[model samples]
Every structure is written in structure tokens, then in C-alpha cells.
Target: MSLPDIKEALNEYEFKWKAEQVTIQATLLKEHSDGRVTGDITITTQAKEYHPHIHQSQFNFSAGRTRETLAKTLHSRVPDLISLKQWEDIIEQLCVKIVAMIREGEPALELAIDDTKNIPPEYLLEPILLKGLPTIIYGEKGANKSTLSILFSICMLLPWKDNPLGLVCPTRSIKSLILDWEQDKEIVQYQAKCLKDGMNLPYFDVYYRHCARPLANDLPQIARNISKVGAEVIIIDSLGAACGGELNKPGPALDFFAALRELRIASIILAQTSKDTESKKKTVFGSTYFTYYARSVFELVKADEIDKTSSDIALFNREANYSARHDPIGFHLTYNGTGIMVQRQDVNIGQFIKRHSTQQAIYEVLKRGAMKPKEIAKETGENENAVRVALSRMKAAGKIVMTDQGYGLLSKDIMQ
Candidate 1:
């Protein structure tokens, strides 16, 4: 069988048909007496209509529902058609173009669902300060973990209630969706007003998705539910509340994490940690699943202060600590007239610089191909001084390598 002509994918008259909504397009590669084998496409609202340009055979599709629905349908049809694999290549290209176009045009308002960027670098002093990353703040029943969670939620909702807390940074506009299993919607709202004194600077969209029936125990079922939310970040608040059945069994909790990854949303789950344990090293008390799978973990401990009102927040590293620990990166929780705000304790600029520099250097080297330090510096438009420093550090970190030919990235795992 010959390769299907790309031109056959669209109709010539589609250009004049005002076919702006090509959200669903199917190219019937071969028509059987009863059914047809198709190269399916579903794009963004803008790309919903199919238009066949004479020069461009593959029309760029859009993102979101269109792309997802199309990919699933085509993938499902793969087993039915012998030629499905061949059409898949073309379909793959179309899928990519659609996703890119949608991202550029829509700018993550509705389409950007994945939470890969929320994870902090391993070395950072404050790995838990990520904007979109899901984090769980768990402690002993009376450890005030729930109080802290409530305060965090209020800070996002009414950012302006306190001094620097209300300061609108680039990340302040971030959208957060929380499934408060422990707290009721009314209580969460009351706390928000109390925290912010009715400042009314709406910044977050809070959802009251109380899990009456524990779905976390059923991994597949829970995964399907979360995937439909289209949220970049999610919070369970208290892990045990939603996770039903025996957590120590290792099947349900592990499966829950797996489902979280599939949902492509960053989450924060609260878990309890016992104080009687002599090990200061241990933070969260749960199955190893707490340490595994999580890109970063933090253990908040009470501070030894003259006044009980003051709290000491000790940060921890679980997996990656690209950010250093020496720097004071924390917040001093204080109550104001309306709400609470965490005042900045300190920030580690040096650590941030090193972490970002390494990440950027690795990315640059991978993108520009194998090259020596001098070549890399020149290509990246960085001074030789900066390049040498970065290269030396990268090499020591085992993120890159030197060969007879030139230097190159050590790992191809860098995501595009």
C-alpha cells in the first residue's frame, strides 16, 4: 500500500467554508464496505474547523479537549486498522502542532493541566515554597497542621490582608484548587475572611470537594476523577481523611501516588508525624510512599521561642536538594486584624543562583549540541568567566561530561 497523500486529509473547499472550528476532523485512509479507517484529529476552539491550505497539507490543530479526545480515539482505533501505525506518525505531528499552538494562544488559562514545574530543585533551602507544586502539611493531631493549612489557603485568597503577604509578585496570580476533605466550605471561607479581614483580593479558586466516600483507596477511580478537574495544582489537606483502607498495606497509597502522576497535577497531602520518635531525621509518619514518588518533602516543626505565639519552621529535603540549606528561607506567621501573613525570615540568593545556573547550563549545553566550555560560553552569550564556573560545577555534579570531541549533556532525560 502506498503512503496516503497528506492533501487528502482536508477538503479544498474547506478554506471558504469558514471552517474555523475543526475541533474534530477524521481522514478516512481506507473505506471498507461497512466502516472506515481514519486519521483522527481534534484541536482547540480556534482550530475546530478544518481548512485545507493548498501548500500546507497538515492543518495545525489546537489544544485541550480537542487534542485529548482525538489522541484517545485514534489510539483506540489503532488495534482495528493494520495501517493505523502509519497514520499515527502523521497524527503525532498534528498533535504536537496543536498543543503548541494552543499553549501559545491560550496561555494556560484552561489548557495547561500538568504540574511538572511545581517540584523544587533538590538543593534549595526552601524546596517547599513552590507555587504550583502540591504539598501536604501534616503533623500530630494537635500540632496545628490544619491551622497552618487554613492560613496558607487564606493567604492565597486574600493576599492583601498583610504586609508583604499581599504583595503581588509574578507568582501571586497563580490559580490554586483545593479539595478540602477535612474542612468544610463554610469554615474555610470564615477562616479566609478572618485571615484577611475581608480584604477581598480574590486570588484563588477554592473548591469544596469533600470525599465522603473514600476514593483514594481505589486508585484507578480516584485518578479518573482528579484527571477531569483540569487543575494545575491540587491539595488533599489531610491524607488519611481521603485515603481509605489500610495505608500500611502499601498497595492503595502507592497506587494513589501513581494516579497523581497520571493526573499530571501537583498535589500537597497532609500526613501525621509522631513526636515521640527519637529520630529527628524522620519527618512524615507513613508508608515509604511518602518519601518515594514525592519530588520534594518538608517537615514543619514547632519553634522554641519565649512567646508561644511565635513558631519555628524547620525545612527538610527528601529527594532533590539542588537548593542549599544554610540560607534562611521561611515565614514568621503572625496574626493581623483580619487574617494572618507569613513574614519573610530570609532568602538564600546564593543557593538559588547556583541551582538555576546549573539547570540553565545543562539545558543550554543539551540544546546547543556538544561543545567545549569556550564554545558553550560563546554560543550561550555568556562571558567565558561565567561559563567556566558553570561547566566546572556541572561536571562535578555529573550532569555533563568531557570527551575527546567536546563537552555534552550526560543525560538525555531532560524534558522539552
Candidate 2:
């Protein structure tokens, strides 16, 4: 009948509460003659002061119900009366507590086991440039490095068949962005026209930002633009012009690469080689950081007897982290009447001649008839030991046969 009497009756119930800062107060509001009790409960939080945080809600129970039953009923129903904002605040507090617990190392780290087989690296060009990885294409001045970079961009932007360099595009189509900091708008436009006309495409899926702001200062905007265009691959033409500080310095170089990694897109960074550095290792014009961070590195060098402006160029795979180094591939950047075009030479004479000179000489000598190793060496003017090595290799490759008379071509069908 009285509030104190009702409180005393409810205190006998063994109701376990989870929140130490919260309290519930129940009052008997009415008593029905047919042995029913109607009441309301007020839920509040207690600090130094009591704060009514939840709206009061009615509860009904039979007169004969035990304190345990009443407490349990109230416990279950009180949560429903809490406001949405109160619930959100409670969840935020719990999250903060959980974060603190984690920081205190209450829970051990979790390990996830993946049963899937290891996947191979995905590449734009097999063994050369991988998807979602950074690559550096560096060359001496006038090596047509920009042309090569443009070719790559064109390949990625247009249909695979339109790719003049014959690079394999894993996807049906790829959107590419070219941030050309070195070239002017007119030059870039001309180059783009040439690529479009040469590929015989009305237009390409490529976007170009000719002569962009320096990379060091405008990385955020560049990253946003890449995302805005949904670019799968981005090319930064000429790292020196894009970068703000000296490229030879580690701080600037690292910062530049860090910005690139943040874009999370496959990137090709074009750079110039230092003069007087003929060797591939020293030619990359920046700090070792560039090579260290790059997933692959390629060098383009002008072939001997070729004019600096000539289309003939040699591409050498200097580094490949995911795949074996590919032999140098020859590319000619010729201009048709309509546009500039790149064509892969049928034969990579530089690599072919370097790797197979002895084999070629031996084969030429054997073209006439079978001959002993000494006779082959004397006829070909090759070292006797070298001839023996070449003969052994050729024999194992089924290119040649040794009979009682001498060694001879296994089949005349072999190409010279």
C-alpha cells in the first residue's frame, strides 16, 4: 500500500544488475481487488547526484507473485524504456572501455588461418610490371622514356589489341591516369593524338593532367583525382619534375614514394639516368631508395649507331621482384603520317647476338656438313673450348647430332 512497504518487498528479490552506476526505483501506484498489482519504475544513474535518465514505465504482476519474479520481470522490461540516445551513449561508453582494455593488453592477439592456396603476382606485363605495385622506368635523356611511358598508358587505357607494345592486359579494360609534369599541354596533346591515331581508336579510356603541380606539394589533390577518375594505373612522367626537393636526397625520395603508395594504385614512375653512368646500377638518377622501393625497374637505352632522335631503342629489365628477369626487348618508336607508333622488333638483335654468338657461329659452320669440334672452331674462328661448349648445348637441345663421322645439324629446318 505504501512506497516503503513496496520497496521493502522488492528488496528481497535477487536481481543481478550489470551497470554499477544505474539504479531502479519502483513504487506501488494501484492495487486491484482481484489480486493484481500495478506499479511504475523509474531508472536513473547515480554519481554524487541522482539523474533520472530513463522514462518511467508501468509493470503489472499478480498479487501473489514472489519478489524474485517481480525483480526478474522489472529487469527484463527496464531496458525497453531507455531512450535511443541513452542507448547510443551507453554503447559509446562500452566501446571506450573496450578500447582501454585492449590497450592494457587484456585480450591476446587473434590469429586467422587462411586455407586458400598462394596466388601468383598479377602483372600488367608478364615478368615486368605487376598490378598494384610500383615500377620505375628510367633511362638517359633522349632515350624516349616518355614515349615508352606513354605507350604503357595507352595500352592500359585502350583495348588490349590497340596496345602497340603487345603487353598483355589482364583485365577487359583498365582506366589509366597520366600526370605529366615535364611536358607542356601542346606536346602532351600531340602525343595523345599520335597514340590514338596509331592505335586506330576514336578515343582512349585514359585521362591526362598535363603539367600538374609539383608532387611534393599536391599529392593529396593528385590522390583525390586518381580516385575521382577510378584509375587502376597512374603514370608520373619524369620524377624529377614532379618531385620538389633534390631527388638524390632520401627524405624527398621517400616522401614522393610514400605519397604514391598512399594512392594504392599501380604506378609507373619515369625517371632520368645520370650522365656518365653507363652501368645500369648507377644510372637510376635518384637515391637508392627509388630502386629499393620499386617492385620492378626497367632501363631504356639507345642502340649503337642509332641517332638520339631515332625510334630504335632497347629495353632492359634491370629488376623484377616477382618474376625472373626478361631478356631485353627491342622497340622502335616510328611515326606514321598520322601519329607516332611503337613496334616491337621481330628479333631482339642485341640480346640475341649477345647470348647466342657462339651458337650462331657453330651453326653457320655446320650448315655445310658435319665437322669435328676442332674443324668447326677453325672454320668459325671461335675458341675451341667455346665451340665444344656450344656443341654440347646444341646437342642436348636436339639442334645437332653426333655420329661416327662428326657433329651435324639434327634438322635442316632449324632457323639461322
Choose the strongest candidate by TM-score: 2
Please provide, for model 2 over 79-111, each residue's C-alpha lDDT reduced to its tens digit, 9 standing for 90 to 100.
454444444344334223323422342257886
Task: Assess every candidate by TM-score.
Answer: 0.45, 0.57
Candidate 1 stretches greater than 4 Å from native: 1-136, 142-144, 150-172, 198-205, 217-230, 304-312, 321-328, 336-338, 346-416
User: Which run of 10 residues does model 2 get worst, by summed lDDT?
Assistant: 1-10
Q: Model 1 — TM-score against the truth?
A: 0.45
Question: How many clashing residue pairs are found in candidate 2?
Answer: 0
Q: Tell me, by lDDT, which candidate is best.
A: 2
lDDT of each: 0.48, 0.64
lDDT score for residue 353 of model 1: 28
